[model samples]
Target: MYLYKFNDPEKALDCFTAFISRFPESGNITLVYYLAYEAAGKAGKASQAETLKDELIRKFPDSDYAKGLQDPEYFKKVDSDLRTVDRMYAEAYELYQNVYYKEALARCEDILQQFPGSKMSSYVLFLRAMCIVNLQPADEARIALNEVLAAQPTKRIQTVVNGILASMDVGDKPVLYADAEMYDARYLKSVRNWTFDEEKHAENTEEDRENPYKVNKEEEYCVVILLPEDMKTMQVLHLQTRLTFLNAALKAEQKDEKGDYQVKKEDLWYKTTALQIEPFANYGEAAVYLNRVAVDKTLLKNFKGARYRIFAISKTNFSVLKRLKNAEQYVDFFVTNYFDDRGQGEIITGRQGAAAHLFKYEADEKHDFVLMVPYRQVNVKKMAELLHGIEPAFALEKETYDDRYEMVVVKNVGTQVQSMEYLQLVSRNKEIFDRLSGTSSYMFTITQSNLGILLENQNIEEYMKFFDDNYQRNQSGEVGVGDGDFVYAKSVAHKFVLFYPNTIDPFKLKTTFEEFNFAGLMVNNVKYDDEHDCMVVSGFRNKEEAMRYFQTAVDNRKLFRSLRNVDYRNFIISDSNFDTMCEKKEIEQYLQFFKKYYLE
Candidate 1:
């Protein structure tokens, strides 16, 4: 009865075979005799069906089952119904071949009901189970496969179903980190099940209990610290530790009416923590955040002049982001974007117009490069001329703020180049520089506020003559000196010196500058004084050659320190008040301060 309920006629036939053998002479076996014939027909055993039918008619001619077999018209209708079922099976197979699994499944269900006791019923049920594979979820479809298995399907069908079940296991998928969804590949690999055992689960529970913020299983944001591949593991570990501490210990200074937190520099418990290092909901937000950080030199000082990258995975399962492949892909973006931004910054900052010494640190191939047209109208002709040496590839721009800002995507032309400095070296055309710099020192902005007047249209000699008069008039006031050029008092030096305070590690500072590839400056000597606790870096170069450059550095420092409440000068390696000490030839002043710690 159970076998018949589940449509397992083949298994029911096996039961009858056992019963007939055990009770060969039982008088009440007439019901079993008729059922055996019907079961054999349903199980697709034609020879067994014919034999059962013959026995029923020859031995029990007076029985109702034998009388039904005597009707020729009934047999003819059965044969016609078999042909119609065969056609339906063909159509279902055709639909399955075309990937129309839903329609194929519907047709299979119809055939199963219309020909419930047909000889081809088992084969049709098998088709229905396989079709469900494409149309239904793995667990739900497995139920249909189990039904087919109950009916004693062919060995070939059983093998295919077993293979599918093996593939459905969750352990077979790849694992990734929680933050990987920010990139193009939202999910990559599967995270390992670390808490699969009771002991491990207990350990995780204890760790969570000790943690400051309760771990929310519903959703979490995983913060991952990004750094250069060549960076020391100890440095990375140190940064990760500090970042974790800051996230837990720090609170915002104030919240706006809308509840957005305004985190000021003083509100931070850790002074070295980056203010720009906020949580990002997606890659788009991360990209903008990074670009803003790259542009703002003050933000770089927030980390005490340490170079680092940080990214966030917004509102996702940590297990989903732990895939190794996703971690690789996310890190690859840092490498690619770094070089891209470097190239762009060179053009945007107008570094080409100034002498090399003014730049405290140079850019290497690894530095972030990017070209940005500030959210305003720009002269297309001047922009084209600035990029004269390099080939311009078509950039796909993402429109932001109602098309006020066009975020041009990095292309092969920008990233494929060796380095931003390499481009400056090879493509720095003196003629182009003279033409543009003579008009307006600011390369990205317009000289005049007229819509039709482009920078290229202005006369170079007249513009400079006009600019000089205005520059001298306001030299002591608000207006900046054009091209960041400066004239300083003459000095005697057969060498150059770069001094840094004890706030940051000198070795790390050296590495950071080495990565920048500062244009004219080279590390000639490094002296670490234990007594003063300061590092003095001296470069062997004729000061006469780099006088104009260092003069610009001095002037920029004076301007930077003049800004109200600007404490960045104390920590920053470049353009710091240390330069003011250096300007006064006060090497002893720094050495004297360090002596308080060491010599005392």
Candidate 2:
């Protein structure tokens, strides 16, 4: 009974078969035959199932089992259908294991079409829902799971569905909070033009002049704003007003690309005019100017709780964007116009080692020419489409760019621009160049460990791919605790813990762990022991129960290859050391298990 309840029907079937063989003439022999029949059916032994059914009916015709087996032909058909469904399910599962999601989904759909109201309906429905989850977006998958839920599935199926739901919500909300104090160093230099280098042009040959699509230059300023979702109408007005004021203040001193003098300065923003500062050349200077500008406390107060990173775009880059229709043209115009001394402006002076903590801007490196402006009109995929050889890396928060921009570092900027002869001006220091390029790279806000991987790989595509894959894996598990929050001192005693070996792929380990988590076998919490460079899983009630489950997993070979070394480490927590492993949070549901089952 325990083995069957634990989902090991094959082992339970063996036990039942042995029991019936020894007690053939016992008073409860008919019951034994019936039990064996059920066990055989569950274990997918159609021949054994039919034989047991026949034995129960022939030996004890007056018994309830015999009465239930009255319709032999109907029973045979039921057995045949059950075997067919099991074979189809196994094929579908195999497809899923190979990552052939489309094929797996097709197989599941076929089962639904062929066996609409069979006994395997609930399990089939669950399988279909899981296939949809793997095949579609989270929202679509959620809808499918809800349909399964509507069918009122078995407790096991319900638990699995609920677990999937719980996993979908992990890290869906914003975690990085921002307010007025979070402005970066480059917010004030939005109006300035990029400093063109005469020396860079002096070094350029005739080839550079003729083929102009290549550039290894940086933008002067990029201001990013991290905004909260659903900005109020007044907040939008205030932001517009601030931008208008800043531009108005710079019009008198700054020259247009045509070298036309600006219109006379108007006192449109009287508060900012009092500083008597000209258009900002440096970000630090602009920061100082903004601090001095006497804007209304009420108007400034509006941005206190709001999240926004306003990019202080350079006049040159801003002009380029305004003139260009798409990224392809944007790239073409920059390469043709600014490739030589004819259009190159003056080199920036004195600014070095300046950094923006709130946004992503480095003063010393050459900036990436590609910009993902906050405007909704700037479509990332369109740009990627126009520039075929190019690919995007990571997208910022949906609120940051209004779901319009993706931050991409060009690894290999295609030289073929609009059928023109173009040269490739690749940056030598891509990392430093990107930093100084004034593009925002902090949108993902990855962890230190992930940061290490990015630095090691240095391929933005690889980094973003790993990030996305990790995010999906994190969203498929019951225990959705942040890995960074793992505390050794806070671990509880007598709790079940899977002490893993030090050597293991962290990503693979996490994925395998999620697969093992189910209804009764819940993962209450997780902890990453950084000092030992391993994972500690503690949440189950006692050592004995935890060990029993662990042994069963080993016997069933339900572990990843990396975890197959059963002697690598202990799988259960000792009573003396369990609670002392870490402290417990009062809010965690796992603590209740300790209080309920162990405290008394």
Candidate 3:
């Protein structure tokens, strides 16, 4: 049971089997078999599952365990119904059992607020009423007890509530109290246990995929409010609530993408010992937010506690404190590192050298470029479609124009003279270029070196100046009429079994696939055909299984309209290795990779 609870079901099954072997005659042996059956199923042992089922049904026929097994989805329903609140209530009950009434009260209040829809809420309230009666005034405790009664608790709970009310009415003396101080960190378990996984988050962010080691020593600042020590739980929660309301009001003034989302809502909140609000553009922005919170008239009413010092912290040191899971440590790291008695924007900036690669690029070698006629655009597919008929050169080559754009380039246009003549030909026929580039484009006699420089600096003025100084009039370029949209594509190689016959309705094909389970394919592939007029089904599957798929089409002629196996004239490859190799009008690498990996 211990092993299974912690996700080692196989070992748990082994332990259960061992126990049954050693103690065959134990009267409570059916309980072991019941748990063993569950572990066997979880471990995916089909034969072992059948054996356990037979043992329960044949030997323990009269037991409740056998009767429960009659329902096929019994264990799945059991696992789904056990909510996290059930475990939280147990933890709170344990604290109460240990005579920590104040801690119990805080835990109960947290559970009630955080899980309003929880089935155990009324029970948690009853526990809270018991705690408040000991510490708070009679009126306050009475109000809480009455609220619990209003919730219409269980009969057993109602009896406890009535007893507590009777005792409070008679004005009874308090229970035993612990006078010594407990550990500070334990008291602030909410904040002390939570760690911000900054490194993990950095890895997951979109920009990190390109040169992930690149780090910034200075940017991404946050606001930190030093919460008052020796504060009550209610006071801490109230402050957090007021701050949340303030943030909501600030955000409400801003515009967002207009849509209403139907989502399964979770109140992803935790009681904080110290509050840290984040993601300001810079320290200046963070200062504005912090200052407003301190003096705002609407906020002053709710924030009746001692004045807490609010300040900005750098992403570097603030991450360290959160990583350490000690909010007080933020003060120590701040003083040691970026914090001065100066303004919030005054962060010391010498540490960039240590993490230099994290902030800047490393192009430590000299390089040169080969001249080419590449025209970049936002709609490269539209460019290809519009220009494929006019002249093959206009649509002959399309490939990556760095990370943000793809381009239709001139292939096999060798020397500076050849690139110039080609550029001039397209430049003179301005309408052909204009029609090809839909909106926003860079049509230039660009080099690989020039493109690299553009990617690194992203300064168009500098690049244009450089181009004008180096290239002649024949190498001149033009911008498109409309704004050229920047288009980016990420290509992945998938081995799809495609059949483009003179037809098939996608809906009928999809319905047939739903009715029957096909082997050697993932569900995303099985659910639909790739496109109309073709059946492109599955990727990275066995040829024999794909061959067997033709039989399905043959069996259901209504779904597949005259579909048959035929060799496709063209195959696609996405790797740059294939791209460069094919650039010289060669396709040997593509033939080897495409034929080898395309179908099988």
Worst 10 residues of 3 by lDDT: 259-268
Candidate 1 at 301: error in angstroms? Answer: 99
RMSD of 1: 33.5
Badly placed stretches (over 4 Å) of model 3 are 1-217, 226-277, 295-301, 306-309, 314-319, 335-339, 342-600
Q: What's the CA error at residue 247 for candidate 2, in Å?
A: 76
Tens-digit lDDT track for model 1 on 1-600?
A: 423445777887876666567866644244456677778989999899788888878888875457667874654565477668877977776555434566778999999888886656767777887777655666667788788877775555567666766666643322221223322121111111111234656876786454222223224233343343233322333343333223222322224322111221111110112222444444454444334334343222233322344443344422333322243343333343433665343322222211111122221212221233334444434545445334444332222312333222223222212333323332244443344332312322111121012122332232222222322222332221111222111121222334444444434434333322233344322333432223222242323444444455445544233233422222112222234444555555544443332123
Per-residue lDDT of 1-600 in model 2, one digit per residue for the tens?
A: 423335666776776677688867654466557667877888899999999888888889876457657854654565567667767976776555434456767888898899887656766677777767755667778888998888777665688788878877783411221222112211222112111234335555443455323232343333222233334423543443344334334443556521111112111110111112233454453433333222323323344433222222344554454333233233344334543532111110001101111122222322223323334434555443433333244222222322433443332222223111111111222232233233333222243333334444343443333333333223322111122222211112334455554555544554445445432342332443442223344445544556566566656555657777543433444333334444542223333433333333
Question: Alpha-carbon error at 341 in model 1, in Å?
Answer: 82
TM-score of each: 0.20, 0.21, 0.20
- Candidate 3, residue 554: the lDDT equals 46
Question: Given candidate 2, what's the lDDT at residue 198?
Answer: 41
TM-score of 1: 0.20
Candidate 3 per-residue lDDT over residues 380-450, each given as its tens digit? 56655544544554325665544555556554443555555555455445455445433444555555455
Assess each prediction's global lDDT (C-alpha) against the native: 0.42, 0.43, 0.49
Give candidate 3's whole-model lDDT. 0.49
